[model samples]
Target: MEGLSEKLASKLHKYSVLPFEDMYGTVSPLDAFVFTNYIFFLIIAFVATLVFFVVAANKTALVPKGIGNLAETGVEFIRNLCVDSMGKEGVKFVPFIGTLFFFLLFANILGLIPGTLPATGTIGVTAAWAVMVFLLYNYIGIKKHGFIGYFKSFVPSGVREMGPLGKWGMGSFIFILEVLGHFLRPLTLAMRLFANTFAGGMILGIFGIFVVLGVKEISAIGLLSSGLSLVMLVIMYAFKLFVGVIQAYIFTLLTTAYIGGALHADEH
Candidate 1:
């Protein structure tokens, strides 16, 4: 068990990232830029997403069918999510949010395939996405209400209304805390996606190892344990599929909420 644990620990990092040279056994100029397994899968996801949408667009009809229907259904889901989170203003963001949702959904699904890594399972990929979201909502807020006005919204209305001493004391402290929390949003978003997907992959890998080890043992007990592990792996794979969809929805939902909050900061 200890040896198995050690082996699992050593192999688990493969789910995160692997350099081009390690993967292909040849050095390339791209290696200097840190091209990796996750990045390769990320590009595949991006291209797949682009092709899906393009095909869907070309195949659209009054009564959508097949890929068109699936595309329409996905778009409607994202549109509703945005509207519910941000109201009418959210409609304008449907394109961005929808793309993000589908990309993540595809990435997660692709990772389920043998020999492919989940792009979002990597911290760099998730962090890049979260940073983009952070920059976007903040930019929207700044554009809607000038830079000064947008930042001033960080302080609670009640705090700003207090007496001079109260305003400078409690208000400043709250403002600082709020700012810190705001900055932490990207970190939370990145970590949440990376941890969930990466952990899911690791669990699957560990179970796979167990199945292999069980099969290698020559006893009847070995066969029974391998069968049990196989069943559990199937169950876990199904759960991971559900989790992938939920994570994509969650990330998109939070993004819309953040944008909505920025759009209506004065309301709070």
Candidate 2:
């Protein structure tokens, strides 16, 4: 079991962010600053996403087909999510939200390839996305309502209705809690996506190790175990695909909800 664990760990390390010299045995002055597995795959995912949408756009017509239909369906899905979560005002955010959704979806799917790592599996990547979202919604809020008004919205209406002393005391307390929760949003978003993607990859790698170990044993028990491990690997691969799609949707959904809340904070 320990040996199996060690093997799995070594396999998983290949997917981690490492310097170009360490990962690819190449030496360059810029390697330490800009070259890493994470950045390499991220650029691949980004370029792939850009090319897909561009191609889809060119293929657009009154009656869509093939990739055009797939692209339109994806657009409609994001459009509906935004509109449902943010109402008519959400229309303006469709492009940004759609880009986020497709980029994440492509990244997650790309990782399923035997040698690639999902960028979202890294905390740094997910954190960058979460921070971008945090800044965007907060900026929208402050733009819609002045800076003071935007901050003031953190206090509940009931707090304002209390007696003078109670209003100040309770309002201050609730305001602090709200501010803390607001700041924690990015942390939670980053951790959720990172944990799910990283853990899923780990599980897949473990089962893969089991299959390899079983194949090497060569006895009756070995064959049985190898067969079982292969089955589990197939099951896990399918499950990972579903999880990839779900995590992408969940991230996008939460982003839309956060933006919507900021856009309509006065409604609360």
TM accuracy, model 1: 0.92
Candidate of highest TM-score: 2
TM-score on alpha carbons, each prediction: 0.92, 0.93
Least accurate 10 contiguous residues by lDDT in model 1? 23-32
Q: Write the per-residue lDDT of candidate 2 for residues 2-114, one digit (tens) a residue.
A: 37767976877765667645675533434546577777788889999999999999999999999999999999989999999899988889999999999999999998988
Candidate 1: tens digits of C-alpha lDDT, residues 1-268: 3268776866675664668458534334455677788889989999999999999988889988999998898899889999998888899999999988999999998888878888899888899999999999999999998898888888888888989998889878988998898899999999999999999999889888888888888678888888999999999999999998899889988999999999988876
The global Cα lDDT (0 to 1) of model 2 is 0.87
Q: What are the RMSDs of all candidates, in order?
A: 2.6, 2.6
How many clashing pairs in candidate 1? 0
